[model samples]
Target: MTPKEAIRLAINGRTDIGQVRDENEDHIGWYNHPSLPMGFVVIADGMGGYTGGSKASQIAVKCVTEHLETLPTSTFQACTPDQQLLVIHSKILDALNAANAGILDAKVSAPQLANMGSTIVLALVWQDKVTIAHLGDSRAYLWNKDGLCQLTSDHSLVQEMIDSGSLTVTQARSSRVRNHITRALGVTEFIEPNINTYALIQNSLLMLCSDGLTEYLDHGELEFVLSTHRPALECCYRFISEANEMGGKDNISVGIIEYTLENKVSVSQANISVPAPSSAPVEDVTVRKESRA
Candidate 1:
């Protein structure tokens, strides 16, 4: 009889105030134990150009991480794949909802903080799969030797226009209303996040970041740097530097979790068509969250 081995991860995260912002409104929550059955990395960007954006980001990260850790760790580590997904899926929603409630409640206690909100993105690694969820423009990306796949889409007015063919990617990048978002954590009574999961692919690197990083760099530029497959720390450093170099007009934040399975082959799945870099960004053909290895 053979025994199963635990999966390993190289996790790294960083947030910068950037050259333009006087305050670093971004907050990060990361549990980067090298060997763990489950863990997560979360990043929230304060609604830039608004009062209390920084404080709102702080509260959002704190609420989500604190609420998510309330899960049944022992059961999560030992449950069947189907059961694990159910547990984590429910937890992610609960945590996000708690974060929203926490922020709204804060507004009632302190009216000065009203209208403040933040964009959130989270990546949860449980067993051998990564489940992701987000609101607003914060993003999650999956990268390996094959290429980069953008997992989450932006929740912004400009993005809505882009989706409806009213604007192109290039125009959206240069739009004066680029930072305006349609959804956030503390602004309103209701907010729903987009969530998905994928089987853990060995040598796969998951990256999460604020719109600051995405602002200066697009998908093609990101894939170029990640293609090197450098250690998570170095890659993060480069990401920040590049963003700053390209007119770091806003706060820059990033989190990287590179996965590796010692002495084991990568998880195999059906019908993943990831293409090489081209004029257009890589297409997403990765497996879904419900599908386990």
Candidate 2:
């Protein structure tokens, strides 16, 4: 039997407009196919002014989800598991490209929204593996008994500074330009998303969140929460509440996926190999504490 047929997943998501923001510009969503062993979680953080920010994020989430839903599932299922992963990665990039175009088109129709843009992080899970994709500073993380590992890199000015050895983690956290992102959807004609795949170990958790939660909590704090073994929904609320307690200066969004092997099958020890997308060159930044304005 396929790994997807042998496992179960519990998913939950949450978004909050923190103490300082007058409007919530972050969006989170998840979709699980009824028949196929496939699902996805998406989070977007918008930028620009009040109206533009909200609209841009909403549009990005909607467009990406819609595009992904249209992929040929049966075609993908016919390929080997490794090949299926590549197809999924390609489709995710296609979705992001479509979303970028949709946002750019919205800007043309509404001149005032010219400055609108957004950061997006998405996780597409198929049976025992997951494909994670992202643009800008939003992130994806994996947590298990071993601890928490950040999977996606931040595409931000502060990250660039740290990568160049010009700024230390302590310095970047408080830097005035810490929130300035180097890449975002709709900011340019095209975007190169960082995509990767990983094995979804049984009893492990996958998290996707905007900078809001990361702004307040570090990796140690995140590990503590996941170690509690609470339900995925409870973890989502805890993350949002903790971020708010820590000065909630921006919008917060999170999506959690918990994987479990059912009684029918034993855990597989195979590793899923994911090749980098060939569309554009993407820089891989080391994980760090990131802040948002």
Predictions in order: lDDT? 0.76, 0.79
lDDT minimum window of 10 residues, candidate 2? 284-293
- Model 2, C-alpha of 254: deviation from truth (Å): 0.8
Clashing pairs in 1: 197-289
Candidate number with greatest lDDT: 2
Candidate 2: C-alpha lDDT:
0.79
lDDT of 1: 0.76
Each prediction's total of clashing residue pairs, residues at least 3 apart in sequence or on different chains, is 1, 1
Against the true structure, candidate 1 reaches a TM-score of: 0.87
lDDT of 2 at 42: 95
lDDT tens digits, residue span 83-202, model 1? 767888788877777777777787788788777788999998765677888888898888877778887778888988987899999999999999888877877666667777776655
